[model samples]
Target: MQVQPLDIVVVGGGAFGAASALELAERGHHVTVLDRTASPHPDASSTDISKMIRMDYGADVFYHELAEASLDVWEAWNADWPRALYHPEGFLVLSAREAEPGSFEFESERVLRERGYDPQHFDAEHLRSVWPVWNADRYPEGYVSPRGGWAESGAVVARLLKLGRGAGAGFVAGSFASLLEDGSRVSGVRYVAEDKSVRTLKADRVIVATGAWTPVLLPWLSDVLKPVAQPVVHYGVDDASRWQSPVFPPFAADMAGSGWYGFPALDDGRIKLGHHADGCVVDPEHRGTVSEDHLDLARVFLAESLPELADAPVVGTRVCLYSDSFDGDLWIGEDPERSGLIVAAGGSGHGFKFTPMIGKLVADTIERRENPWLHRFAWRSLAEPRQEAARMQH
Candidate 1:
């Protein structure tokens, strides 16, 4: 059989890769997106039930800017379709005595302020007075951003996948085996389709947005991308009305202490809980179960920090993967060692909030274009290193 040449071949159907395909396809590129499974399918980060979409980047100037820009894009899309892609419920964070006021958590507030955003601060006394459901006596302070909120991650991915199809981008269900290369230049991608047929498609450019499975596809960058497992559990409370407090924002309890974060109750009466920046290192293909100890930690956090939901039942629990970088930043751009291959992986746990902007970033990088945020997250930079938990403050 004769091989057909394409303009670009993207090796992941996740949000980043699908966004890249849509952006380029709209620009008239013959794009083909190859993925291990059809999009909107489970097992991919982009299809998770929920994802945070907010502008509080916590002192990362580059991400702050991207978040701001992504908000505009999300708004534009919402105006076009009127779906629940971005919900502006605001974010509420309670800090403890152990945390400093102007640390990472505080710095994020500062960034938002510098960008002309309005975020309210509440001392422990004020927090308890405003929200009787919370036991703010345990915390020193709380921060509330009326602008921060949640987004339906899986729905957004599904919508984009549908848009990509309407835009003429081909979606092939397959697992990326490896890249077909000629010397240092990437020529195409080798993958096995859902039918178990091995096929190779040639392209002018190849983008690897495989998320946690990125290292498995390109073993040469094993040291750069490490997959970590984090515990995530969903709870159902008896009275969802307790979450209807006016001051309640998608909140974090230990941002002042242990870095725990969670969302407000969804319309479905479930509130999610998980800690940030503290996941166990594991392989993407072989993730393990969430240990009993981990569940105990979450239970204790909810019980000790949130009195209203302390007795809530653990309705659901699952393990999520975080593609971590040493410095907790993402790896985005063309690979240094290979030509025609661009990477946009290792988002740590913060990539979701920047989906629209990250899509633009990946699209721009793949086209050899200039993007402002690229200066902070270069394709090949060794200076910015990832250090293990220095402080648990969110």
Candidate 2:
């Protein structure tokens, strides 16, 4: 338990903010979530039709464990809710190489087998038996995990926001104006409301989970927290149901090399394909438009992978913002300079999957609990270069 009850103001009511608010409020803290838009902001990274929910993180055991546990929670959420948000359609990992060293697919299959999860490898002959859409000549080998799929990300955010509010957590929607501080100690924040009226809200502790906007809002941390824009393309398919049938699941094509991954068709018959590359550095505030080069790249990928979608018209596109840290790990701890401030914004694109566990860590951090993950996430500095441990890093 915390030493005393805290008045916590969580900035950015997306995945991190809503989860933190719910956890903190459940732990008896007076929590309020301040979002720039409605709690589930459409522009927010969390507001998507679907996101991959796989327990595969290559050789990164920590994240492997995290996702494995999270999958269970997502299943539990489906059981608890009347309408299911999670889709256990399975995840297909197409590898260009056949179990090569340092390969993402090889590492993921190795780890899953070690952990006693049955992940099946499929060569060309085996691949043709299960996957109807798989290009045998293009992808000689791959693996399938039945426990993985995608989730209704935006709907999940809305459900979590509702849960947090029901647990006595207040939510205020408007853009964040500025920090309310007293000599390096942040007391709260000043925000501009929907009516253009300015209001000052006080808190014992301020947690900034504002995603890619974190660096722009707090300029001092700009070097470490960079806002990168990743391209997302949604295509309207005529036979959407057939695209995601049991034979054709959600998959990544030569994930590490091409960074090409896609989801099954949504209820609206739209299929979303997103790349996991390093992405372009962009200002989060003015980022909505995707470049022509990205669209060209998408067409090229579909031509090579799915010939059927070679000339498919693009229905939607978004330059989704990712709050990337210097290293590819999450940053969730107190600011060294500020007395009552906590920094918890770095998602690095693989964050939304950990929605089940992140809030508990935030709550535990505030209570000063000794958690093993704290060692990796604590405030620190290092010169090591960014490493790609997740299955896809282009």
Candidate 3:
């Protein structure tokens, strides 16, 4: 932990950037964070009403352990933070059929039991008896862990921004135009200021946490880091309490199969659902839009999974973007080609939950400390994107 304070500039004040700035600044480093818009930018992926926070990674023990550790932090944050950002409503995962080898539910149950956690397993009869809202016949097998639930993602990001600013981290509003380099070393950044005026920021080191825009901003990474657009739907209902009730926790129905998962109703009477399958390629410039087919899929999922929600009116939709890597691992650590530059993008789809813990890991990498998780996140060449089977991504 003993290191000289270095002037650092972090691009993108979303979850990753804000957390990094907070951690770095707390370590007595002069940190400046720049973003194209506000801290909880409406366009940013992490700005959301709710996001799942769970330790279920199927057979991947690394993330399970990391998630459990982060859960402890989330519990502390729940007590310390003024607002309710973390929710321990628990997470329920269902499968279309009985447990089979290599299936998401099966593997998750296997791993959880191995770790000595008592996950409640339900059969068709039990599921129907306990959760009458669900069409238990279709999803006859499932499990619910009291350990996992959802997070108020946007509020958490805003809270981190406030903490960073309060801890002496400078904040700037701008679009990343280019990086200021001294020969092969990155010195700072040149960006379009909030007033639309071009400005240059100088720093000893720069960390790029620009999420989906990383590929477009640094084209060399396009082959390694890809940005894709996924669909999420929010439905309007008359009895909000029915949908937002304590019994209705965040659950996935055939997630790795149908890629269907949903959050309980928000305070605004809207129930959110998302598909976690491979999203379509998108350009962040013009941006992606939700198509009729995507909405139709949402309809079909509701009809099959939650019959009561089948006829509910569609309130809103989002073409959410994911920074996917060729191998589904995060892209972090210093760029081998560029000195004084660190790359921390590629959230895939499950990165938001790690906001409470990623900062320390990212800070460790930035400070040149040897971290056990570095090898998986380091820059590498993957011919084709192979999303890990351990995590449920439909």
Best by TM-score: 3
Tens-digit lDDT string for candidate 1 (319-383) = 88887766667788888889899988877777777777776677777766778887555665445
Tell me the alpha-carbon RMSD of every candidate.
Answer: 3.7, 1.7, 1.6
- Candidate 1 vs candidate 3, lDDT winner: 3
For candidate 3, the TM-score is 0.97
Name the regions of candidate 2 deviating beyond 4 angstroms: 382-394
Model 2 score (lDDT): 0.84
Task: For model 2, state the Cα shift of residue 300 in Å.
Answer: 2.0
Candidate 2, residues 1-394, lDDT tens digits: the string is 4268899999998888888899898888999999977779988999998888888888888888888888888899999987989889888889876769667888888899999989877897788667756667788998897688888999999999899999999988778888899998999999999999999889999999999999899888888889998989999888777777476678888888888999888767798999988877788878768789889988988887788788878999988988888777788998889988887877888888888877887888888887777666677665554464463541
Candidate 3, residue 12: lDDT: 90
Best by lDDT: 3
lDDT of 1 at 255: 63
lDDT of 3 by residue, 347-379 (tens): 888888878777887789878888777677887
* Pairwise TM-score winner, candidates 1 and 2: 2
lDDT of 3: 0.85
